[model samples]
Target: MATVLVIGASRGIGLELVRQYRAAGDRVIATARDDEGMTRLRELGAEPLRIDVAQPASVSGLAWQLDGEEIDVALYVAGVIDRGHATTPPTQSAFDHVMHTNVLGLMQVLPQVMPMVEATGGVFGALSSSMSQIGPVPGSNSWLYRVSKAALNMAVRSARFDYPKARLVVLDPGWVQTDMGGESAPVTVEDSVYGLRRVLASLGADDNGCLIHHDGRRAASW
Candidate 1:
């Protein structure tokens, strides 16, 4: 069975990913910030590691947690959304929280985990949003979130060069129904994670450094 590592798997897309992967009988190591989250992960048959990605000190311990295991699939799925638009300036606290969680956290995690992925010639996928697209820009509903994810896209793409053996890609999970997406979202969490797993399974050398939708459509431009 493939060994999978999911960073930030307490809820939403991340939690659902752990559930599905475990259901498929893969060995899953997932992270959560609190006791309750860890308990939930354990119940789902995942090896739970306590980690708050927004905190550098906490994230620093992840490498030791995994030790020497080679990971077949590693996903950085920790992120927070910002709803404020460009019409008003975002407060420093707001920007810091969003950027730290969405971009900086993943950046910190990569150094610790990418080597594990490389050892297995695995696929490393980060959850990004289509709203991050600059070309044919969508309306600025969550401008700060847009900026953070756009930076996330660049971070993963740039890091891909250093770990050539690992297939690194950014994935857009679509607007799935979750605490972040709300009830109005058309896509279900099950469907979104299913598609994402499919995309991860189908990664090729040429697919490296690309942004792909959950359904497998690749972005034409960054």
Candidate 2:
């Protein structure tokens, strides 16, 4: 069993990941901003902590709390989808909110967790999306959300250069049925998480810096 750290384990994919990891006998350290989610995590035998990814202080507190412990897997599953881009000019508040939480927030949290993963020679993964791809362009809606995810992909790439020994991956969980993916999404949380676990378990230094699909497929482009 490995020691796993899951960020944004409040609900959906994050919540399911916590459950699956615990069920597999891995030690899970989960974080969530909401009370209900934290309670659920505790019920699953995970040590849940309070964290608002948008707030740097909260993330710092978590890092300080963990201190020198080695983490086997650190998965960043926190993100937001702002449909405000569907508007004519797009709402500035909504745009800023997504960028802060999805981009800047990740930038801040990675530093605190990377060392822990490095100590254990483990993997560090970021939850990305297929929509973040530039070439095979999808619909034009949610443009801002797409941009934020694209930026996040780059951030993970940059991390690979710094943590040479650590296996770092950008995971695309497919279009799953969740609060962010919506009811129309074809994949279920169980299916996505199961595939993701397989993909993650198979990662190696050769797979570092690659964008991987939940089913273990790899992509060259971000």
Candidate 3:
């Protein structure tokens, strides 16, 4: 069995990933920002680690906590969508928060956690969105979110060279039905995660730095 780490495991896709991983007999280290989330993760048999990805110190603390452990699959699933409507510009505060959490936060945590995964010759992945693409944009809504996720994709791709021993990729879980994806999203979290698990299991050295969709077979445009 592999030791998997799911960052931002409080709810939605993150929470479901923890559940599925644990149910599959993997040792999971799940992180959340709140006590409630921690409690729920524990109920599902995950070892909870409290973290606020927007804060560098919390990410550092997690690195310290896992200093000697070997991680097989480290998936960073924490992210936020733009709160403002498509027709209007997003507030400065919302933009800043999204950029910090979705982009800067991943960059900060990558350096700290990647070494652990690399030690085991494993893989690292971050949840990126297909909407991040520029050519023939999928939707005009959540412009800030789109921008932030695009930046996130670039960050992960660029960082791949720095961690040569571990395979790193950006994953688009598809428009999964989560709190972020909303009710109308076409893909259910279960279906997304199921395929995502297959995608993760199938990743190899050559697949490093790719942007992949949840179908486990297709590559997403950068």
Per-model CA lDDT versus the true structure: 0.94, 0.88, 0.89
Clash number for candidate 3: 0
Predicted structure 2, TM vs. truth: 0.95
lDDT of 2 by residue, 76-191 (tens): 99999866444555577877778878888789888888889989899988998998999886677888888999999999988888887688889999999999999999999999
Among residues 3 or more apart in sequence or in different chains, the pairs in candidate 2 whose N, CA or C atoms overlap within 3 Å are none
lDDT per residue for candidate 3 within 15-104, as digits (tens), equals 999999999999999999999999999999999999998877777787787878899999999999875557898788888789888988
- Residues 94-183, candidate 1, lDDT per residue (tens digit)? 999899999989999999999999999999999999999999686878999999999999999999999988899999999999999999
Q: State the lDDT at 28 in candidate 3.
A: 98
Per-model TM against the reference: 0.98, 0.95, 0.95
Candidate 2, superposed: residue stretches over 4 Å from native: 84-87
lDDT of 3: 0.89
In angstroms, what RMSD does candidate 1 have relative to the true structure?
A: 0.7
